[model samples]
Target: MVLPAPRYRKPANDLRPALPPAQRSGYTSALASPGPFTEMEKLLAVTAIGPDRAGLVRDLSEVVTRSGCSIHESRMMALGSEFAMLMLVGGNWHAIGKLRERAAELQEATGLTITLRDASARPKVDAVPYLVDVVTLDHEGIVLGLSEFFASRGLEIAEMSTRRYNAPHTGAIMFSVQMTVNVPASVHMASLREEFFAYCDAENLDAVLEPAQR
Candidate 1:
């Protein structure tokens, strides 16, 4: 799949909704073909959520390692009191079932909801022509708030990275976020910018939206 560059940053609309095991669609690695494999190899998308606290990070890393999975990429964040994790894991295609089962176990132990999906079959990414940067203080309702704002305006957040900023002793909770979004041709950039600023102003958050340089 062709991933949209940073210019088109939109939330994946095609992402399958999370469902319970009995209702799940079953284990199928979108990353693998039917061809007989001499070696097992598949890509899996794993998601986890939990209350923000120490050692949660270590527990997650250990889970992936113990499952015989190799981490390809990871993006995570602490949304207010809750922590979210997204990981791209590579392992034998035949082991997908075991991985899923283990993932469920991990979720149970961590007391965090988790899900697994075939990253290869992920929703098609849309390409746009802009970059979005958001900086705000860490607080409850930030992720949902931002997602709602973008959704209301018909924007897609393609890729986002956020982290807390602080000095060693001080330990501040300020956050800086950068996202790429897909901008439709029909959208008015100027008006969107105005509305975005107004929205940020209301929330006391700092934002910058601009056209991406090719």
Candidate 2:
């Protein structure tokens, strides 16, 4: 007896036609398929915090590198006994997926809290840069008072570092603040200086304000 003709089965790939040239999503490399990177159009802001220990940076960085992404910028520091790190990572789609998938693994291995988010391009600010230095007998309200002083003037504090120490000869406690502030170019420098010093005098503190070198 003649056997019935075997039924034909279409291959899986044959069912889906190639993406049309114009209809294809721009995110994909070509009209054919997706890969690690099609356009490299995203930036990821990654933040992590963990107990300070040796090889923490190495471990985190290895994850980024092994996944074929680069750490464009990173800031790592020991805050008290804990370590904090912030990194700006750039990668294509697949690379980003790898980073996300492996984040949990990293957490388990290193015990760090890691977060990832999309980041926009940095905007430019035209405000003039200035350095403000203050030194006085250590006391309460120094930082609050200074912060209020700048806020009143609508100045932006880009960065500030404060320290307390004993005076070299007298052994008296001293506090100092060094801050980088952005002042609008429209402000009159001479008059502003006069006004700032007047406030410092009233606060019983010494201050010096001047342009910051690039």
User: In lDDT terms, which candidate is top?
Assistant: 2
> Which 10-residue span in candidate 2 carries the lowest summed lDDT?
24-33
Model 2 ranges with Cα > 4 A deviation: 1-41
* TM-score (C-alpha, index-matched) for candidate 1: 0.49
For residues 1-214, write the lDDT of model 1, one tens digit per residue.
Answer: 2223222222223221222342111112221123222244687888889899898768877777777777766766789999998887777765666778777887887798888988552443333445566666578777778788888988877565555665234454566565566667567666776777788778877666665553
Task: Please write out the lDDT profile of model 2 over residues 66-139, one tens digit for every residue.
Answer: 88778876667788899998887888879888988787799988889999998754545555666676777789
Lowest summed lDDT across 10 adjacent residues in model 1 is found at 23-32
Residue 43 of model 1 has an lDDT of 78
lDDT of each: 0.63, 0.69
Question: Using Cα atoms with residue i matched to residue i, what is each candidate's TM-score against the true structure?
Answer: 0.49, 0.68
